[model samples]
Target: MTSEKKTYNFLIAGVPYKLKTSHDDATVEELVEFVNSRMNQALGVTKNGSYQNAAVLTAMNLAEELILLKRKAHRELEKLEEKALQLSMDLENSKSNKVLNN
Candidate 1:
């Protein structure tokens, strides 16, 4: 018999996130680290505030930044794909021309 994997969704601020693990005993320490890193990048601890509020605000900021970065990466990927296609076509054309000349 095989046990089904468990998936959990967690939201730091407003973003919905999903992760799959083998069991309920899966440690969330990694997830916490990821969240903390993003939060720190988004909101540097430059102001005096409660830890909970700061965490929430940081998450919100990080979510927005992540979205923007994802969009930018997608656009860059599309451009690279287009360039690859063009290069492949050019290579094929060159090969065909060489064959005709031979």
Candidate 2:
């Protein structure tokens, strides 16, 4: 588990880029593929196929997805926590009722 960043060279939309990160080779490759796929989609849909514009749009799209996923995860976690709390309260009440009956 080395914390040092490693360099990864990849091409996106025919442009070369070097990324430095702490991710393993396979993880980095997956990330590169994801970005390249998004860039290609953006480039294909753009009127002029402007690389810069496509990249920016792709970034915005990825960011939007990330935010939405985070929000959905948060909501799900909250619901799970609420259910756990309710279950704990029910369990405590049942125990108290048993003790009183005994």
**Least accurate 10 contiguous residues by lDDT in model 1:** 41-50
Q: What are the per-residue Cα lDDT tens digits for candidate 1 across 45-87?
A: 6365455667777767878888999999999999999999999
Q: Give the clash total for candidate 1.
A: 0
**lDDT for residue 32 in candidate 1, whole number 0-100:** 55
lDDT by residue (1-102, candidate 2, tens digit) is 359899988898888889988889989888888988999999999999899899899999999999999999999999999999999999999999999999
Instruction: Give model 2's TM-score versus the native structure.
Output: 0.93
* Model 1: per-residue Cα lDDT at residue 7: 72
Pairs clashing within candidate 1: none
Q: Candidate 1's error at 9, in angstroms?
A: 15
TM-score for all predictions? Answer: 0.53, 0.93
- Root-mean-square deviation of each candidate, in angstroms? 6.4, 1.2
Clashes of 2: 0
Best by lDDT: 2
Candidate 1: where are CA atoms >4 Å away? 1-27, 36-52
Predictions in order: lDDT: 0.71, 0.92
